[model samples]
Target chain A: MYIADRSGEVIYHPDQQLIYAGLTEESPVADASLSDGIHKEVIDGIPQLVLVKTVGYTGWKLVGVIPVKNLAADIDELQWFGVALLLFTVFLLAFVNTHLSEHISRPLSRLNLAVKAMEAGKENVEFQEEGCEEVQHLAHSIQSMVSTLRHLMDDIIEQEENKRRLEMEVLQSQINPHFLYNTLDSVIWLTENGRYEDATRMVNALGKLFRISLSRGKTVIPLKDELEHVRHYGTIQAIRYKERFEIRITAEPDTEGLYTLKLIVQPILENAIYHGMAAMDEDGEITVHAWRKGGDLYIDVQDNGLGIPGEMLDHLLDESQPLKHSKGSGIGVRNIHRRIQLFFGPEYGLEFFSEPDEGTLVRIHLPALNEEQAAAYQKEGTGYETKA
Target chain B: MKRKHKNLIQLGILAILSLLVILSLFIRDISWPEKAERRVEISVIVRESDSSIWSEARQGMAKAAADYGVELRFLALGESNSVSEQTELIRQEIKNGADGLVVVPAQTEALEVIVKDNPKIPVVTMESSLEGACISVMPDNVWVGEQLAAAIEEDFSEGHVLLVDAAPGSSGIRARLEAAEESLTEKGFTVLRCGADFTVETIEGVDAVIFPEPESAVHALQLLDQNGKTSSLYVAGTEERILAGLEYGVIRGVVAWSGYGVGYQAVEQAASAVLGKELSEPVVESVLVRKEEMYEIENQKILFPIGH
Candidate 1:
């Protein structure tokens, strides 16, 4: 509030800052000198409700400059207060809902994902125990159930692995007696033909083959020993068939210490002699080659003889089909395929490649294990079979 | 924490804070003690309330009263500037529920004493200050003297100037007389003085006269006119006779201070004091007028307030 005289000189003002600073400009309220009333005027861009009163004889004006908004300041305060209150409530509700959802819904979401993973057959899925007590208890219960289920599954797998080992052992036992019967028959033929030297060599080869096949009651042996067993079996077969087929056995120097399932090659050799070469008019050719590739061992047996028919060859190593017909030692090639899978894992098995009238080749695939690794393999039984 | 408990806590705190805010606003409404419903009544005590000299001043007071939403009562003090009568009026107005006072002090000392005695009643003084007035609306007498002296210098290089002084008890009268004397002396003039003991002999060697008060000017002019003396006069008023004297060459010039400003600012200060508005001492205007410019628009506004 200030007072200005007739000539617009500010004789008195409430604000001394302006007077002391010598601010020489006339106030906008000076215009109030024109009359004595309330008037609306703008000062410095702000609309003011200016009330002017003339000092009676002096023509001085007393101006009360009130901002227009100040007139309704109470109402404005109420409106702002209401708006602020509403915003605060909404914010508070959102905060509570967010925290509640995090406490209850978030853990449930994680639990749902874990259940999905379990349904999808992932056994090593990481489980989290969190959120409210109910959710925590649910998670704990599920984790326990999954733990017990895994243990039961493990027991089933161990039983299946032991059963497979027993089956392979029985198959090996059947192979041995059958091979002995065939060799004894061949020995009798040799002795009756007055081939005493060949009979002695056949008996000696049989002794060495049987000795190596049952080496310290082990199912796995060095490739060289297996090769030696193969050579002795080849000698016996040569004496029995009167050199009807020539068999060449060769192995890479790196495969010397690599071991394989015992008695694996001898049956294949027998099948090559009786089923593969027996029908060939011309002398047959058999090639046995062993080599190491990556961490695995490969043994290929190729026979240049009457190739098995395409339809029959397709089922030769198919374990899903039964080997209703058997030849040589009464052990079908499919049985040997199953024995390799059960003993060394499905990835290590026999693969047959043949075409009609183009000879047959059976590739033996096995993990390349030295002596110490083979012992671990015998102890562990088998890698869990993920046949799919 | 439980959801139910947390909600309760939040609501309780909000309600308490809201109640506190409402309570504070309510307390403010009650504790401040509202002013009375009736308009404030201010008693103005002057020498003579119906004097023509107060026509513009009364109008100024009326306008200020209307602006401040107060009421004014210009009390009649008979035809005299009597301290006893003015003091009796002040006491009566106080008893009659007058919120404040505007005193055209009859005697500065007596009024100051009265003001000190009635400390609760705010008083605004005009033209004089002794003590305890919330505000004093006075004139710049030195400027008035300078203006009058400059007017004389414009007509004459030097002269024997008679300074008519009155109301020795009033500081305003003393200040005006001293200012005029000092200014005229600075102009290398021969200065003479008149007081309550004045006679025609005091005007003997005087080439011109300066009256510092309106009453003194009026009294001196009537005496000069009665005695057929046409000595040039410079008076401190825009009274009718002073204007007439200026027109007819009896008065060379008039140094009239704004009488209206004194009344208006005095009432304003009084109203502000009782109404709880801040105030400060104010100075009213004093203008110089000669016969040549007295009829001009701005000068006419000052000298003749009723028109234009």
Candidate 2:
């Protein structure tokens, strides 16, 4: 409240000191010199409800001022508080929204990861088979599809194995007819030369060789029986060679019980006598020695005769070679090497060590299978235990 | 990589929220007053916050506050003349951390004890002086008295002059009364002493009346007008009614001082004392304004300040 005389001289004021000091400007009330009334005005740029009343007959004007900002201060504070609360609510909602979205999408995300792994050619993809019914059913269906694919793949492999075994049987059946014709020639020559005892011995050896070679149409035989077949072949061969070269057959003590592919040693012995010992005069010797080395059986057909040259020895087991100098099976050494690998994996096959004029050693390698494993192998083709 | 990116976004949001909390605590106007650069706070305690008596003084203090970068608050008092109540207000202002005080003292001697007890808060008084006051800004009482006497002497050489004493307990009003009495006596007039509560019986034989205080000047003028007494009145200071009295031919002369100057210098001196600056004692001018010359530019500025 403020008071001023009729002529604007200040009489009293809340800040009367400034009016008396004459240091402040006149307020709008004083400047207007208002009469006795209530008024609305702006004082110092503040809207105020002012009352202009005369102090009795004194002609003094009293002015009251109230700034509007003071009236709405609480409202302004409430507005700011409302804004802060709204911001907090929005932040909390966003936080919860993300979590809820993750909850609904979690299982789908796992399923997608599994499917992607499968698409990237992974063989072992795990499906959780959880979450919504659609996702679980999809996982189950994919697992069943994978099981069917594995069975089909196994059937295809079995078919391929059967085809390979049939091709090997065809090669085994092509044992050369020249060996039988030559043995018959020896028998006929002995009978006409008046060596009837020698003829009978040769006939007996030929019959034993043929019986063992037939072996009930079986592809696998015992090691002792294989040695017997090779011995009969050697007797017939010695009679044909007119004792120009001697044949020796021996085996390690425990090796004769092991199983091997039939007709394997007989072919190698035939090669040794005809090709390796062809140039030997009377001092030629062919030794058939068999031994068990670890879990494998090895038969060495060695001839102290003319050995193969370096160039011929490198490709002796090459499948591309069509023929060889042997009066035995035309399937040749390369075919025999391949057939052994097909039965016992590639680790068991023929290995040749030869030198010119020093003789040749043809080592036939086969798995040392006991009786139970031999039966399994003859039935299922490759049921023997493989080396680690 | 996608997971890492999402985590980074969450961390960014958390960082922003943390930053907002920190800003709200430290930077969104926590209202902690700055120690080194904040304005010096001063509180003015007075009998009433809305009274017109403090208008000019508040303006001057406000001007000084603006100039010195000081913060000022005027606390209103419930009791106009209660020493204890004003003293408690002073304590409250000091307790609220006032650096200085501008007191329009109601009881000079009694309030002096409170002011002196709080020596750390510099004090400047208005209208009167207190012993504990670091400075006081007031109109010179002797100058006002002599001006009122000189204005009276111009019209009357001799008369039964009734001297009215208002606020006898106030030292400033008492000095003004004594000075006016001495000046009136020296001018060869019959000076009669009277209290501000005078009845018609006291004014019966009076040829002239003199008021020693501004508020009482207007009050005495109304009493004379009511009694239909036209004896010319002289006053040591002027209020609005005294000006009206001058127009009504009831007022002979008015010795008016500029309250604005006194109020301005009070806060100026108080702020100076607070800042350890040298004190300036300013003289507030008093003028003898008559009805005929009240409109003159020179006398009007002092007698009727522009826009109050």
Candidate 3:
């Protein structure tokens, strides 16, 4: 405690050295005329809480000076303790929050990721039945639904595949008799013309073509064998037409290893010779070209014969429409289209482009599958499938 | 949801309790007591003010007073070495009901009568001895002087040494110088005495300059620097001067004591006499300091009297 006179002279202080020293010049309390209350002031850059009371009848102020920090010592300690407790509590809550979120969302997030993987064509995904009852039930439901859907889809695909294979066999058998009859008729005519060597060659080509057609009961064969079959068919047709038309078959060396449906090119060749080149007066030309472009093999048959009218050409590949002058079982171009669509999906099929008297070009599009791919396509009904 | 709400309520209650505890702590006042019980008042009188040495001594006295629960009042005789002013301050403290006295007498003989008359009050003299004082707390000056001479002798067996005498009036300083001179002379060395302002020309032929006081050592260092001389210097003084001289290579070694320890011991001795307790010892210990061994623990205690 310190006492200062009315004129601001320091009269008494517990620190005796500060007394008799000029207090009026240094202390803010000396200049303050506070009546009787606590006042905060700065003295020599230190904050002080000064309690000022006027001495009765003396007009001297009795001041009690305490540093502001000293007054808040207890409070400062308590504040530090509170802050430490708060930090510890927040850290604990963070740990609990992490554990809680992991317990609640971990299984759900795993299930979501499994569903996404399924959408990306990953099969037979297994989801864990953990977490809450609702989440476990949802996982169980999804697992059952996926299993059922997979079984149903497999059954439908197998039945459809069997039906398409049966139809292909039937169509393939229908072409055999007509092809043999035409070839034998040519062989007979060659012998009648006294050309015994040509007749022997025609008979040998017919024998080779039939051997490749019945290739161990396999529906798909290498393009090399398919082209050879077409060559034999053209030789017999050339003999029958008697030099009125020419048949030229060419294939790229790279396409020799690739596979195609059996009797595919033979039926198309028959259509071109009978329907396209039969009524031609001058010598007509039939060119068969096979090559590989990207992931597809294209075989185009161009015949410089009397081109079919646009109306008939448009309805040629439509099975629902009957041909005006079709000679076969009325399923010629449409059967090829259906067989290709059933084997390789609708994206790989037949496309025809023609102009009147300018000849017709038939493009047969098929996937360039190797030996292993063709075997997988036949067994598991799976291949390098492309979208339409 | 019910469990979560209950947890939030518990958290809220805990928060409120914490806030209340903090608020209660904030409102509580922390201040010195208005009055202490049966406290004895002791007055300390020193000859000079505004000196770092005296300020450190006052710190020791204040610590003792706090430890012993005694009310202490420190009185200074302005800044001069005035025996009359110090004597008058002691008389004033006695009149003001001082229960005991700790004085560093300006002149030991001049304050004898006043100390003799104050028979009821216990008195302790510091840095100097009085004939009738209850006790005297001071450094062993004779031993310090011998140590200083031995330190210098380590480098020089025989040389003409110049001793710069700064405190000619203090008997304690005089006795230390006499002992140093006697020890150095007995070692087959020549000793010469000079004032603080001794020029480089006066010290040209001297192999070493010995200063028993800090001021004189500082003065000799300045002279050596100004003259660009390479003479070896030694001091028996405070740590500030000795450490600085050693660091700058101006002085080779020091013979010193802990000033703070001396002051602390003085107040302790005074309080012991006041409480009718037997005194342990009157003299404080000194240390021999060298540049190489200055950082050793025992020597460092003397060099840094205070922990800092």
Candidate 4:
């Protein structure tokens, strides 16, 4: 809507001289007054609203204008739709606060690693009592304090294994009277030299080695009756060491029904025949061996002879030292390494590999139990009888 | 905190309903204040200024006075074809303050007493009218002479038709040459009323000449191309020299109108009778063109009167 005239020249505009090329100035509506209303101005920089009037006596005014951002175009489209609904409600509340902190920190981080593995003592502290009820009452009070510290550590380890099985039955009745006084002194020197059939085959191999070292009070046996009691103590030490040492038992047939600790390989085969073949004379050897692996049963023994000296094989199992040439009670390899760590907890025991004269092995270890876990460890007295 | 104060009062009621829908779209885009645009001035009093058909009806009255923002002015009393010099140029355009007149009436019965002595100035008469003119924008001249005598009786059914006749006292070109001489004498075609002469021996044995008048159909196609007359001409009128004599095949058909829609409906009926509105038809249509329907869009808007 325009009409111009006085000296501004644009006789009439009606929308196109480059859309009112800044209303080619009537000095910006020259204080618009021929009388009508609205003035405001600005033009090229936009903000218009003009209106004016007067075309009658042809002084030619008229005006009309408009622009002010087309009157705030609907409040800038409702301020961009309230800033896009406040950024889609802040991205849907950051996706529901990351799914409620991963559903409350994933089971409270698995009950904080089962209470840091029960503060590191770790006796099986399983947790997951599921979450939120105060974290399932703190994982059911740490699984009832790890089941009351594993039933008070299995009642103080079954009263220290009933005082070490009554001190190993008084050290197996003092080793059966020193092995029946060395097998009745080799059967009174072969029945007074008559050599009664080698004194009845050394009294039937010392009556099958004292009926398998007094089996009735069994402390555990079966590796085929512990290799048939070391083959009747190597046939009375090969008729009392006459053949100068060669006891190779080598068991295995699936470790003949497993079980172990009863005079643990006959005190490591009497320390490999009195301290490793008592200073081997000519090719003295002692093998024993036994097998079954991972679930542990291993025996070993080994002994080529005269081996114990890496400074006495570092105190040869140190039962507080006492082994110049221990022939007996020096507590054989620390009492079979404290009865295989008092029954397999110290990861089974005895490792001694020797080397002085190149052979000494003695590996031991234990726990392959079988026969219904050796009759449930001999009715829970931590078991021992397989003397068949 | 009470659901974060009910999410900040529902984001303060969606920011106060988006600022009351942007303050009702800025009060519906600046409410309503701007009205005053009633200028009007219209004076168009032509008989024939420099007649290219009155300069194509003053280019449709200067495009209806630049489309309704009227102030037009055109006065050509056609060099005094004097009816008191076109009644003293409509009394000096109603004393120079014409709120609307649009005349073309050199003598519609002597300008119907100067258009009933300007009954409050809103005149509007074009090719002839004025029993007190307020609307006349003419052109259905007896339906453009009965559609140019039914397009010359579909090309001369019987011969001898030479009807030129419209320049005497122009009673709208003598009522379109008496409706193409009573439709070429009822189609038996022996209607010869000639005035604008075309002589190849006066259109030798005329089978058709009928130039009702676009300047006598360009003076009868320049007297039938200077008398080498190959007769069939039929023009009623749409002058760009009668559409260049129907694009040089020397005019075989045309019964047109729209002298730019009678000068844009005589300045939109003199600006709707000076804004008292209501005049959609005071006679404006007429068609029947033929040099192959002469570029059709309604005969190229009555043969390009300033290209519409």
Computed on alpha carbons, the lDDT of every model, listed in order, comes to 0.75, 0.74, 0.74, 0.70
True contacts kept of each: 0.00, 0.21, 0.00, 0.00
Q: Comparing only chain A of model 4 with the true chain A, what is the TM-score?
A: 0.31
Query: How would the docking of model 4 be graded?
Result: incorrect
For A1-388, candidate 1 gives per-residue lDDT tens digits of 6777777665565432223222223363356555778888776677888778887887777867778988887885576567656656665665676567657987898999999999998868877999989999999999999998888778668757664665566456545776688789888988998989999999999889778866876777788898899899899888777787899999998898888887788778878888788887657889999999989999999898777788877777765767666666665666667767766666778888887777889899988989898887666655435221
For model 3 the TM-score comes to: 0.38
Q: List the lowest-lDDT window of 10 residues for candidate 4 chain A.
A: A15-24
Name the TM-score of candidate 1.
0.50
Best by TM-score: 1
Best lDDT among the predictions, by candidate number:
1
Interface RMSD of each: 9.8, 6.3, 14.1, 11.4
Clashing pairs in 3: none
Model number 3 iRMSD: 14.1
From the highest lDDT down, the ranking of the candidates is 1, 2, 3, 4
Per-residue C-alpha lDDT of model 3 across residues A1-388, encoded as one tens digit per residue: 7787777655565433312111113463464466689988888789988898889888787888888999887897677677656755764675566567767887898999899999999977888888989999999999999997888778567747754665556456546677668777878877888989889989988888778877776777888898899898788778777767888999987787898977788778888888888887657899999999988999999898777789988887787786566664344676677777767877888999888888989999999989987776666543233221
What would the per-residue lDDT of candidate 2 be over residues B1-308, giving only the tens digit for each residue?
99779868976785676565455444434665654555788888764433454564565567677878888887766744456777788888889888899886667777788877888889987667789889777788777777777777788888888888755545666677678779889989888887757776576568777786656566666666788766678876555677788878788788777755665677778788888889976667777888898888666656665442
lDDT of 3 at A203: 91
